[model samples]
Target: MADTDDVINTGDLFQDPDGFYEPEKEPTFAEHRMRSGDTVRGDLLWNAGRTSAHYIEERAAELIQGKDVLEIGAAAGVPSVVSAIKGARVTVMTDYPDPDLVDNMRFNAGLSAAMIPANSTLHVDGYKWGNSVEPLLAYLPPNSAGFDVLIMADVVYSHREHPNLIKTMQQTLKKTREAVALVIFTPYEPWLLPKTEKFFPLAEENGFQVTKMFEKLMDAVLFENDQGDEKLRRTVFGYEIRWAEDQLK
Candidate 1:
């Protein structure tokens, strides 16, 4: 037998490991074309987000220009950036506090820096829904009531978070009748459309009024092979939520 010192430490070399290590995944991104002719990239650019940005530029320019605007669940912050370009007084873009997600949002914001107007300021923050709005509120001008507009894009798919979404809206939306929260989403899972639709009624119960704005059909479904009604998946639904008449008082 060989001496112990000469023995190689190759014990269990032939044995299969209990688990295999996977290499860290490199992040992937999708490119989006803004109405201003600039291109932005994100992990994935949901059609609802693109549509919301378009709506802001075309239909809601009056609401965004020179107003305090906040975007929750802002994946790439396209709408917030567009709002800044449109001359919003303050545009705050927020998403869950994941390093990768937040960093990507900041990157996109930086890319569009030159396009943003001198009078408008754009900020980025990591925020979770239903959390304290104070941090977000801090970005507003001194003595300001609250944001004039809130952008919610492609967020209602999570059926469980409806209440939390509404809570954030209540906390941050200004009480004035002109203040509005834009909730836009696509029913990716067609079967769950009813659950997604429940958000509007719940918002009404929470002292808000919901108005259906428009239904847009995109050129293609975001996920072509997704198991759902192709038409529903390609369609983007938009709504405006405002303080109920009583709440505005």
Candidate 2:
């Protein structure tokens, strides 16, 4: 594993390159019978308030209850925290190790501590995609097969980290045929929707199967002022990924 210090700062400079300076603020989202607030700093606000997040929040009982979840590039960890609140056996929320990003995730987790189910637990950590999974898997409960679900929201916007994201999914997701990864994203740059979507093919090549779950036209324009395909900015794509039958461990 690369030293955490040596890991490139992809979580900021690359993962969410479009994010820019904004005055410090606290943003909140309500979903899954839960509400969470985040301390916003330098990181892009990709937490559960977004349309993709709404999808997860709406399906919490079906997807999160009694499961183990791991969320990658979780800017404010809304889905992870919400999953824990909805009764996930365990929810690990991770982002880049940058003090600010990690600290903000912790703050958001704290915001919902009172709502976490008695049978569930929530943990926060800084994780660079494609890094060793041992550290993350270590958080699994004793005798757990692996994470029952993996959540990747908005992180797929970065064209360069596709493989790293897939690699992390392979290493951390449970091998059971039923285990799945929820990939939800919007092509903020409408013109680059094709490139942003290539991540699915790459995942198929790496022993996973991707199924289109839904496409939602969000009420809010993700990049209202950005110059891109307007239709793409307002649409959110959702997918369910699982190990191919032949690749199941």
Candidate 3:
């Protein structure tokens, strides 16, 4: 964790759970280390349960090369920065309203941008779920239909936010380009399947066809049964959805 002095040159520097500097305290999410690339400098909340999973990142960059991109639920901007670093025309890092991640994302974006050539532009931003695209519209041309690429990761943690996530994806995806939303989840309860279906159906209604691109295993240790014997049946899976152009029909 980078301190208020912006200089934590010693070992075992921790941000107290209440705050980064609340007199003497402890680091909440195990040990602290300054990471490289776009900085996305927030606290343990965003860092917790966060990973730059290969399946998600590889698919996102696969969709984003030579394209304009928007990454929703971009907790720490890892995918967004990767797209920018890969030469996407532009990449916007967006997430739910949280001051800590927002500032951290900006710092991270700056860190990434500094290393890039002079001709590229990669932007970082904050967005509220279920809102109109007014702020996001500034980047895309009017009636452009959709962005060249749209990506998300680990955003399927809830059943309620699924519809809103679909709506946001529809609003941001172009009619021609393959709009990809990668949701990797560890099924805590079976309820997620029905809720996921509810949200996924909206893609076709919004004039796009969706497909399951791929699936891979992930470590799932969060949800345990009453017995608490490491919950043998649960596993995390990654999904890639390719949203096709409505007009192609």
lDDT of 3 by residue, 1-249 (tens): 111122212232211244322231221232212233333333322222244333334544466556777878776566666667666766778887689868877876675566544544677778976677767867764555567766666565544565566667656666564556555554444433444454455545544566655443435553333122343224444555555544445
Candidate number that wins on lDDT, 1 or 2: 1
Best by lDDT: 1
List model 2 lDDT by residue over 1-249, tens digit each: 222224323343234344432332343343333324532122345432354455666677877888899999888787777677778888999998999989888987887798776899999999999888888988998887689999888788767787678778877889888899989887766676776788888788777899999887767764446666776677778899998988754
Query: Which regions in candidate 3 have their CA more than 4 angstroms from the true location?
Result: 1-53, 56-62, 141-144, 188-194, 219-235, 244-249
Angstrom error at residue 163, model 1: 1.0
Question: Can you rank all candidates by lDDT, best first?
Answer: 1, 2, 3
Predicted candidate 1 versus true structure: per-residue lDDT over 98-210, tens digit per residue: 99889988989998899887999999999998777899999999999999999999888765667678878888899899999999998877887886897888788778889
Name the candidate that leads on TM-score.
1
- How good is model 1 by TM-score? 0.86
lDDT score, candidate 3: 0.54
Candidate closer to the true structure by TM-score (higher is better), 1 or 3: 1
Residue pairs with backbone overlap in model 3: 38-108, 39-108, 40-104, 40-108, 41-104, 146-173, 146-174
